[model samples]
Target chain A: MDNFDKIAVIGGGSWATAIVKMLCENNSTIGWYMRSIYAVEHIKRNKHNPNYLSSAELHPEQLDLSNDINEIVGKYDVLIFAVPSAFLNSELEKLNESLENKVIFSAIKGIVPETGLIVGEHFHQLYNISYENIGVIAGPCHAEEVAMERLSYLTIACQDEKKAKALSKKIKGRYIKTKVSDDIFGTEYSAMLKNIYAIAAGIAHGLGYGDNFQSVLMSNAIREMKRYIKKVHRMKRNINNSAYLGDLLVTGYSVFSRNRMFGNMIGKGYTVKSAMLEMNMVAEGYYATKSAYKINQENGAKTPIIDAVYEVLYEKKEAKDVFEKLTNMLD
Target chain B: MDNFDKIAVIGGGSWATAIVKMLCENNSTIGWYMRSIYAVEHIKRNKHNPNYLSSAELHPEQLDLSNDINEIVGKYDVLIFAVPSAFLNSELEKLNESLENKVIFSAIKGIVPETGLIVGEHFHQLYNISYENIGVIAGPCHAEEVAMERLSYLTIACQDEKKAKALSKKIKGRYIKTKVSDDIFGTEYSAMLKNIYAIAAGIAHGLGYGDNFQSVLMSNAIREMKRYIKKVHRMKRNINNSAYLGDLLVTGYSVFSRNRMFGNMIGKGYTVKSAMLEMNMVAEGYYATKSAYKINQENGAKTPIIDAVYEVLYEKKEAKDVFEKLTNMLD
Candidate 1:
């Protein structure tokens, strides 16, 4: 028997919907815990998420939609936490009793603000879970692309090799590709840093900078990622690998990137607050920049790009002035 | 005293113009060798390159535009060969009598067609020039962007550590950034392979593929590059480094990329011959694909991407069918 016959996905975002849709291909029953009762009812009745994944049709039989977190949490052997970084702690707290002995996977891609901990790290500490039971889905995959069934690749990272390989096999399919790596910290750090760079890329685009400038920013961003990943993980990671630089390049340049789009709006002369209000959707980079800036300062890691982004987004510095400073800073 | 004061750029193309302009900033007198007397007169009289770099103004007083290969070869202590890869041998033969004791630096980035020899390797064999006296400039730097004063980086590869460091200092300026590496073959190969992939990226865009598919192609191209680089050089290269994958990503996705533009035309149902006829300039990738394809076959290197490109370009394979085959080939 496979280790996981029943998988529970917690969240109602586009990414959560894509994961559920992908998992259903495994021919296993899926439990989806949505915080909004209306969203759950809508998904149950329509067999589709109208707000996020409107194009992807979910089979009604394969989905177990609920607002009661306990019912879904207790029923599954594998638990996938797909909530945003800010809400992960509250959601984990609600499911703490039911998480015992289940394999927990985190699809959240940011560091928690107050504690400055990655989602998996937080789960490990609060739930007394071994590293073996924790896996992180760090991606070159995007929710928008997943809906189109375009080919995408992801890294499933865990400290325990056996657990990592097992999770890799579980998610590998026609449209979705999975690779296993032992450097959970490296994978997680890359995922977070990419969001920060995407914001910087967006700001450049908003500033009316052409493709020339955008390409330069992305190249430098990846270099910064390499330096930070080395500092934090102290592991041998191929910075050139798809999981690291490849993911950063795609997200930084893509039109559908929310963080880049947010930065672009701010660069086009909107205040950070105004941009956020306009976007309606949360730009993860806004939060990620804060967390990364603090972490870099505390850890003595050098990240000029992230610092410049923080200055623009939080310190109310002019985007053009910050960009000029960034260009001049390069030797 | 510096070993070289006056440098001759033996090709009046965009790359040569950009290199000459950069060298001029270092207080070095540049002799720009052009085969066309009309081009020489146009550059000298109007302070502009009529054919290649029309947008950027060149100061006539700073440049000695000439058709006399002997005069250029005799006056300069260092020669920067910026000729097209196909014409390198013929150009060198023309200047052989005047080439003595002068260091040679190749800016061309391709292998010889029939011999499968890198440009630097050909120089070593034909001129009996020691590897210590030969250097290569390869990286993410584009001629058009360099002329526009955009920030760009290059790897200066030479077997002699002292010569490499000295040359790096000579060219390091505001727009041109330099790094030193010993892997000449790897650097040259990276430069060549990136063009091939840029064509592939262009084809993807031409076929109306979104960023999702393009990212997947670029990511896989980098992986193929890493594998091939290791196989050829037997040295470890960081694909995430600015020299390898960085250059590839910039060229593959940028709008200013000529190779990608050419590939896009072909992918949009234009015949390869028709695309070439329509283009105002030569796309180096079209030539590189032929050279690399031949080399890969001879060396038994697995490069499905290059093969697919060759098939599409020369064998009259349909773009849609080729792409379907490529995706099917991937796991």
Candidate 2:
């Protein structure tokens, strides 16, 4: 618990800012690392994140901000990684400091693109961090909701109960509730897989399905997620828990979800490239679908939803045709 | 299967009309009984129900319509009851025709107020209908969605597989998909219980909780539902199925759900009486919560969601204070 007191959040996204906001409530000073020097100076001059979660006021006095990743990593005992999965490799390459001794927790919700490993496994396998030192932070939460001080729930999963408990205490606040789990693999895999399902939800919505079908799709999605997760890491975890199903619901049903928005465009007949170009961002699900589909090929889980989305995005099958087939597959 | 071929829909509500619409797709002649002679005449002339789902065009040429309950019951081999649970006893009071030979399927999703049992159980215990002859028609399919010809799924649950399959065939259409289940008790109980959870959802939204909390509440609700159903009817069933979780989602999330709307009003500070008076209809959950609460006292399932809604609606507990306590109860 003492080692976890000097926690540093890595990345400058909305989710990272939100985590910092939560940590600021419980800590006298928190380590924050971002690549952009201007953003670091902007936060020092102005007590708010300029790029993301702009309305969330930061306590600069309580923040030990740095543009250099190694400096922050060297100073903090616990490093919470929150960068996008696609950029995780490059971010880690910049870190000369050892994560071998630190209690590492991933606030990242994706599989590292190069390795097809979740951030926790990526850290454990590549960086030699023990499973005991690795943990995951998950949510049925949105960063925007945190900015508004709306009530939200987070699940912290670690093999070490004490480490998970310590992190939970730091993150929980008046509007934030926390629970601990030992299922790191299931929670992280679910966190990554939900983006893909959100895309499926978007496609269904874009293809003109109503609330009735959306409900059914979600019901099936959770079951499919359970099946998929079981293949990767067989555990006795309840898939209906808030960390899995609750997170899926918030992402799939949320209008603010970029993954769902990307899917909506696909369902509305936008090519994958066009949808990404128009949005000026790559949806995390686009990459996740490819990775999960490939991973399922080895595990051999019967995943019709993932298969359909893969066909539409990777195989260039028409969204109409793919979802038309998906309709017969769900119930 | 042959005995269930001659079907009569017994109600004048939107749900009854929706069932008739599905039946008309496969049957050349279907019997319909309504208490309102005016509604029967209106449908006969206008090809749509006058009071509900007016947009659905009925096929009068294939319809055998009457106001007399006995006339329809005497002629048809299968009777599907879709009336409000509160009015069911009065409607059944008029049925002098024996139900001993008939196959009964309930589309009504509430407990019988007088008997405090699910409609399927009420028929089995009181009307002397064999469990094999009783069935339940459940939805993640809303009546409104059926009217729009939006693709939806229905679960037909009967102890007798052939009867369930036959009913599924009669109702399945281009936009309608059907599956059969043998767990009649579980399905009926879930059908009744979802409304109570929907009411709970409305109260949360009414009290200004955001989507993050709603998702967590639903995740907890399904888990609570699985636990509650197991106590009453111990069987091998996945509570995440379309008939259970999917139906719960449609009701809890749909803007069209009267129970949710009723809960929203209560959340917004309307007393139950005022909310009922304003809507000009009773929210079925108001009564269902009472029945379920009393029943749970015997079973003693640890159902926090149902308990909270029951307190708010029946015990006159303040929605704000009750929900504040309820939030801590959910994950």
**Number of the top DockQ candidate:** 2
Docking class of 2: high
Q: Tally clashing residue pairs in candidate 1.
A: 1
The recovered share of true contacts, given per candidate in order, is 0.26, 0.85
Task: Return the TM-score for each candidate structure.
Answer: 0.89, 0.99
Candidate 2 clash total? 0
Worst 10 residues of 2 chain B by lDDT: B1-10
Clashing pairs in 2: none
Say which docking band candidate 1 falls in: acceptable
- lDDT per residue, candidate 1, A130-150, as tens digits? 788888887777787788887
How accurate locally, in lDDT, is each candidate? 0.80, 0.93
Please, what are the lDDT tens digits per residue for candidate 2 over residues A233-259?
Answer: 998999999999999999999989999
Give me the TM-scores of chain B across the candidates: 0.93, 0.99
